[model samples]
Target: MTTLILMVAGGLLGWSAYHKIPEAFAVAIAAAIMVLPVYLVASGEGRTQAEEDPAKEDPAQVLRRRVQAVNQAFTEAVALMDLLRRDLDAQQAAREALLAEAERQQRLLELNEEEAEKIRQILIGETKASIRAGRRRELRFFLAGILLSAALSIPIGIWVNSIS
Candidate 1:
């Protein structure tokens, strides 16, 4: 049962490292690290049992094996935790980078809107000035026509009265 627990812990450690490390070589190395202790404990168990009768087994030797197994389990657990931490850190960094990019894009959009508004206001002002100038020119032409007609009528009327 202890050996089974050790194997499960080691497998979990290897799986976590595989996810945290991108390279195949690194993942293999991590798996090897996790597997080595489990292999040692398992092989040691088999060897000790085959070599010695259970009734005659040394108490001290059994105690030592138990200590070693516990130690290996603790080591694998620590490694798995470290890998999880690194993965979380990487995710946080990626999230912060995306947020910064979003902020920059938002600022650019606001600047574009402000510039477009300025251009629109300038066009409106120019159009108004053009309309005012056109109205002034029409008024001048109307006044000039009125004055010319009045001056011509007076001269023609005086000449007609003198003829009668």
Candidate 2:
């Protein structure tokens, strides 16, 4: 309907320009005003694709198409979330396994320390007993040597004094 209006205006302006109906300046002004509408209409329509039919003849069909597009988008988003959840679950499992292994290693380390402590205690006890036995033998040997020397020296001193 707007295209028909612009065409009618263009025709009237062409006739006025040809007949010199308004004379020089008036004719030019009328011609310009007449052609302007047609030019604007043509330019606007040229920018978009030509439709086989008017766009809104069936509101229900348009609404259905929009609904389908939205549903497809939602389905794709849900699928992506499911994939992300699976990936997160796999990563969590891996992390838990690593933690369990670390805990097991820590327990093993504790057991090793306990065994080392037992060995250390046994070595300390054996060392203490050996030292005590060695000290007692040394003290007995020292006392026997002192007693033998004293006995020999006393007799020798008495005999020497008597001779003098």
Measured by TM-score, the strongest candidate is 1
1-164 in candidate 1: lDDT tens per residue?
44454455445545655577544455455555555656666566445553366567676876686677768765774666466447546756886999999999999999999999999999999999999999999999999999999999999999999999
TM-score of each: 0.60, 0.52
Candidate 1 yields a Cα-based lDDT of: 0.68
Tell me how far the alpha carbon of residue 113 in candidate 1 is from the true structure, in angstroms, after superposition.
1.4
Off by over 4 Å in 2: 1-57, 150-164
Q: Tell me the lDDT of model 2 at 41.
A: 43
Pairs with steric clashes in candidate 1: none
